[model samples]
Target: MFDKIRDVILEYVELPKESITPDTRFLADMHMNSLDIMTMIGQLEDEYDITIETEDLNNIYTMQQLVDYIEERL
Candidate 1:
């Protein structure tokens, strides 16, 4: 699941492989803004076939957080 989430994020951002570790901060470390996050959400929804809520998006900022959220849904 983690690998799949990473791949989905990569589809939108050109993040370095080393920078995508589980603890990497989506906004701080990855330099991602709100728009980047929304784009990422879209990719994730398409990949996972799940619609994500805006409120839920607000709570995920790290690779681990996103993985956990997706895992719960899966």
Candidate 2:
């Protein structure tokens, strides 16, 4: 699951595979904007059949955090 999410983000972002470490910050480290995040969230919702609240999205920062959030819905 994490790999899939990582792959999708990597497709649009320039970050390397090694940079996807658990501690990497999505916005600061990966340089993702809100649109990138929303798009990824949309893809995740479609793939997992779950809705992620906007408030919760803001709280997702690190790679581990995002994976945990997605896993909860999964």
Candidate 3:
């Protein structure tokens, strides 16, 4: 799942796959703005067939957190 999520993120950002870790911060480390995040979320939803609530995004910061959130819904 982490690898799959990383692939989605790569579509929006130009970063080496090895650079993105579980602790990588989407905003601080990846330099993603709100729009980038939203776009990625859309892809994730389509890929996993799951809906992610906007309000729940408040608690997600790192890669692991996002993975966990998606896993929970699965």
Winning model by TM-score? 3
Task: Please give the TM-score that candidate 3 achieves against the real structure.
Answer: 0.97
Tell me the spans in candidate 3 whose CA falls farther than 4 Å from its real position.
Answer: none
Query: What's the lDDT for residue 5 in model 1?
Result: 75
Candidates in descending lDDT order: 3, 2, 1
- Model 3, residue 23: distance off in Å is 0.5
Candidate 1 regions with alpha-carbon error over 4 angstroms: none
Pairing residues by index, what is the TM-score of model 2? 0.91
lDDT of 1 by residue, 1-74 (tens): 88877777776678776668999888888777788789878888888898889998778878998888888887
Model 2 lDDT, residue 53, Cα: 94
| Model 2 Cα lDDT, one tens digit per residue, 44-68 | 8888899999999778899899889
The lDDT, on a scale of 0 to 1, for candidate 3 is: 0.97
- For candidate 3, write residues 1-74 as lDDT tens digits: 99999999999899999999999999999998899999899989999999999999999999999999999999
All candidates' TM-scores? 0.85, 0.91, 0.97
Using lDDT, give the best candidate's number.
3
Score residue 8 of candidate 3 by CA lDDT. Answer: 93
